[model samples]
Target: MFETIFTAANRALVAGLLAGVFLIVFANVVGRYGFGVSLAWIEEAARHMMILGAFCGAGLALREGRLVAITALPDHLPAGARIALRWIIVAVMFAFMAVLLWLGLKFVAFGWDKETMSTGISRGIPYMAIPLGCAIFLVHLALFARRFVVQEFEFHAEDTPSDRQV
Candidate 1:
């Protein structure tokens, strides 16, 4: 269902980001040293690839719970309080994503009407990436919230460190 699709999207985004990094490195190195000449498109291509990588990677990070968080206080709280704190964090994240989504769409619309240009590409093309990324992030946040609501918060024995490991 939606979970499966989201998981697939996450994998795809990671792959694309990796590919972009590889392409940029290869093109820059080969063009500068081996060829003794630079391709005019190389820099622009790398820039766009970087933008795509960041936009897509953000959604994947959200899905994997790898985003930066301040949990020092929450870690010391009781179980109920910890769960409440997690929900509060999630709500704030959702609000932030919603604002990004709104602003992204507005930016795209402005670019479309203004008919801007960059790196030989229409400004709207690059602008579209913002909304696209925010939409994916919104979906990830919603799914994460749904799972949190259903499961509440369970402490797992597996999460604890063994005496030997400690």
Candidate 2:
């Protein structure tokens, strides 16, 4: 139940962010060409939205095995080696993400006093994607660790139509 809700919410957020980017960019283009006026803030807003969307989608990507990786070696390994490798990978990922989350928080704090030139909002608002994305990735890694380590990571299982439904 919790997984369903959490997954749904994440999907909704990614979809909303993508739609916002599309709409904002479309409006800006129309305004520029059709009306001969360009909204100065649109570009900034779209960029930030794209950034947030990418970060927010990281967990979903990882869960579905969509993340880029060199699978040649892992794909050729024996079952026992594969499981061991997966555990090691998970441990490394946890450590890496933990450091990133820490650094991201510091980055946000450092930028809290600053504001974006175009949006005039706290710079920390945009910088927040780092820690948020890292945290989400961590939760996803934890939740899926057992399956991932026990079984070979399979993208097809996660790509079914039912799973695609938000």
Q: Judging by lDDT against the true structure, name the best candidate.
A: 2
How do all models score by TM-score?
0.77, 0.89
Error of 2 at 42 (Å): 0.8
Write candidate 2's Cα lDDT for 1-166 as tens digits: 8766887788899999999999999999999999999999999989988998998898888777667667678789997897789899989989999899999999999999999989899999999999998888888788888866664343554467655312
Candidate 1 per-residue lDDT over residues 45-69, each given as its tens digit: 6676678667767756654445665
- TM-score of model 2 (CA atoms): 0.89
Best by TM-score: 2
- Give the Cα lDDT of each candidate: 0.69, 0.84
Give candidate 2 misplaced runs (Cα > 4 Å).
Answer: 151-166
What clash pairs does model 1 have? none
Show pairs that collide, candidate 2.
Answer: none
